[model samples]
Target: MPGTIAFVGDSLTAAGRWDEWLPEFTVSNHAAGGATTADVLAEVDVVLANRPDAYVLLIGTNDLAWRKSVEHVVRNVESILATVHKHEPSTRMLVQSVLPREPEFAASIRDINRHLWQYSSTVRAQFLDLWPVLADENGALSPVHSEDGLHLTAAGYELWLDALRPAIERLFAVPTTTTPIDVLSDAISVSGLR
Candidate 1:
């Protein structure tokens, strides 16, 4: 049996709809519109409670959209990661880079993602970059992959599904096999599980 995979993020990850992309694994989504890093921390409990084997996290567009400080955003993300560690240590979390915003907001989004990727590199979990697949030569979100300047359209989601396919495939081979919900229960008993 394979472990359950869950996606926990803001609109981009949620909008891409991972379910439509990978049909092989059991998947659950905890994405919501207008969610910032703080919002993510607020709802993370729901995701941990489900305890999927893997988690894909994309957030912070709203935070940048609101002109929140970079330090504040990073702090919130650090908090979220810490929570994930304490509650579900066994669950491997993917820290997804924040997508480039439209013309006006692109720079800040890039800054936020830069920090996220850097943090992911140093952390125990993984940081998956959705930037290249979604960005055009100008470093703006490609029109083909976006519904608006932000959310992904169908083609955009297809591109996302493809970019993440390898990671999803790797989930099947994880030695510990169980339904995602059960895995969380088992994970809770271990130390360092957030």
Candidate 2:
């Protein structure tokens, strides 16, 4: 009962080796480094063309980094969801909160995440708050988790994979008894499942 799942976003999503992490499923990583929501929107047709069973969206930090207002980022994200829904109504969508950045941008990231959490309800998508797991006590990306404070370290990706595993299991109806290592044996050879 394996299903195809796609990850769409900026470097955070692009950088994950999802096929290795979620070996039970066919994963497509459509993320690109430095991609903003607008960039995603532009290429969404290609994404929907793949017709994945589920999509994990994690863009918008770049937009904020570019100094776009929260409202702008939220609107673009809402549109992204809407576009997905319009093109692929049955696709299970997971809208992840924009991960916290340097301390200077923490406030804006928090604000954007709040709006995204609220907006997910409108599109029937689940919003995943990655802040608690990825951010340090000061609400900045943990040095232990990231070297550049933007891209993830091995520990960071491990944390992300842990948070993501159950959500994917729930979406795909995978049983808890199916261990990740076991799933690895079931892995399919997809060339671009980054």
Candidate 3:
């Protein structure tokens, strides 16, 4: 059976047409323009209400833009994950790295992504690093990906879809021992993360 996936985040996620890119699964973009990590925390109820089988999140850029420290954003994200697990222990999760932006905040973005990547592993969520594919040689958001240096262009969205496809396939792949959903729920229970 095809699984349902929700994309939750800011404008970067809001701007994508996920259904068109991944027709094999049910996709919903629950993102809003100019939203931050705090905004996502507020949307937790709405996001989980849908009862999606999986979720892909890419937030924190707007938080950084609003001058919130990277650590603050990370903490908010960890809380968000905990809440998600509490509500739906079996859902698959993929936390994408915060995208690279203009030069001035490049280092901060990288630091946030680094922390998020590590946190994802600890929480049993997969981390998808966008920097390698989206950043230019100088570590800035590649102009080819974003026209305004923040939001993605058509090509950028395509790249994101391409990068995410394999993971989605692996996530929805058939299981050997038990149903994948049951396995995930059991794993979460054993980890005491819920």
Candidate 4:
């Protein structure tokens, strides 16, 4: 069966050619350049309205560049996940870590990724840590992958695609099943979303 997937985030996601990269699925790119986590949170309903079988989120780097606190970004992301899970409990979700950038922002980015990983688990969303593949020894975005230290090069996108494709396949391979309403409600409550 063909599945629909929505990509939501900032420029990194906006720049992807998902249709070409993953042609088996219907792809919707809701990402925009310069977007922050707050931006995605604001328009989450629009993304949800697509009713995709799965969602791929790659946000938060822009927020870091704008100097937003790590907690602020994490909270906004948590709200986004809670909102999606509330509306589409059966949908699969993959939250990619904020990619490495300038060295100065590495620590904060790592902090946000850690929170995202933990929170994604709580919400039953899979988290992809891009650091191992995209970060240099100094923990900055690798120059081979990005010339501007912010945006990715062709090589970077290829690496990203390599990491992402298998995860999506795994998501698709799983048979879809409905969670009982009581269990779903409990998960939402335990997730700390109001």
Candidate 5:
């Protein structure tokens, strides 16, 4: 099998079907109904125990719901990054941009995404922009992608996959073969990273 990857997030990441969408990687998601960075940190030990080769963080929607400032959320994210550094130092990172919420919260969502993009550069973390995938022309969640006007429906997750696949493929292709080569390792080694 390919290296294990863990996804830490809230409801959207836990939407009961990401595995069906992307089966190429071994995905272990630790997501709850309303998880925040704080909640994720609390359970990271369990996730780290898996010796994940990478972590895909899709949190912050709950923080946004709580009306937390972008800086505060980034601080939480930074703390998670530090945790990853200590435990999974060799792990690559992929951070999905916080999706836009309701129209009233659009500014805050934009603010969070701006900081996410800026800070993603600072940390060499790959940033996946959900804004394009989730937002309508007016910058709220596109009705097509969301059922609750916030969380994803099947179509929303499809949008997520469309945006996410390129990055995930790129991650899998990279030579993170940091172990005794197994059969799965050899398969990737021969194919080369696209």
Candidate 6:
């Protein structure tokens, strides 16, 4: 069974009905519309207080919108992850790629995503590359996914959920006994046999 989860990001995250969508787990949305990485850093403590079993992060786009350098966004994100890891080493983390926007932002977004993917490994977090699923041939947020090329439509959210659900499940999945002896022991216990 899934445990508590915290979703942290900007408008894209703030708009999600995570509790309704992920009824299996306790959900907390710590996102705010127009929020930048610095903004997330300021309010990260509130999210930590929830003590969620996992964290799903999706920031940086707003920072891009504000013309913040890729390094600025990446550094802030690293700080967020480091702070969370320091406070809750056992908590799992899922770092999502910054969704595509206008074509001009595509390259920078990819750079941010790559850095985040690498950084996630350092913090032992899983990275979800949403680009292939969300971007169009021109490397912009597909119109099918977003009307404004930034926020998602219902269909977009559906695609995201399709990817996100499995990742979350894997993050919380209990390891099964693979050894023959352990399997036999489990079977015996289940069958009420000595």
Model 3 — TM-score against the truth? 0.87
Model 3 poorest ten-residue lDDT run: 173-182
Q: Each prediction's Cα RMSD?
A: 5.4, 11.2, 4.4, 4.0, 8.1, 9.4
Clashing pairs in 1: 85-194, 86-193, 86-194, 87-193, 87-194, 88-193, 88-194, 89-193
lDDT-based ranking, best first?
A: 4, 6, 2, 3, 5, 1
Could you tell me the lDDT of residue 142 within candidate 3? 82
Give the per-residue lDDT of model 4 (tens digit) for 1-194.
Answer: 57999999999999999999888899999999999989999998998887889989999988887889999999999999988877777788899999999999989999999999999977778888898989998788888899999999999999999999888887777655367456867998999874
For model 2, where is the 10-residue window of minimal lDDT? Answer: 174-183
lDDT of 6 by residue, 1-194 (tens): 76899999999999999999999899989999999999989987888887788889999999998999999999999999888766666678888999999999999999999999999878778889999989998889788899999999999999999999998888777342223445666899999997
Clashes of each: 8, 0, 0, 0, 0, 0
Q: What's each prediction's TM-score?
A: 0.81, 0.86, 0.87, 0.91, 0.84, 0.88
Error of 2 at 47 (Å): 0.3
List candidate 4 stretches off by more than 4 Å: 175-194
Clashes of 3: 0
Which is superior by lDDT, 4 or 6? 4
Q: Which stretches of candidate 1 lie over 4 Å from their true place?
A: 170-194
Clashing pairs in 4: none
Candidate 1's C-alpha lDDT?
0.74
Cα lDDT, all candidates:
0.74, 0.84, 0.83, 0.89, 0.77, 0.88
Write model 1 residue lDDT over 19-115, tens digit each, in one string.
Answer: 6566666889888878888888898888888878787787887898888988888889877876776667667777877777677766766787788
By TM-score, rank the candidates, best first.
4, 6, 3, 2, 5, 1
Greater-TM-score candidate between 4 and 5: 4
- Candidate 2 lDDT score relative to the true structure: 0.84
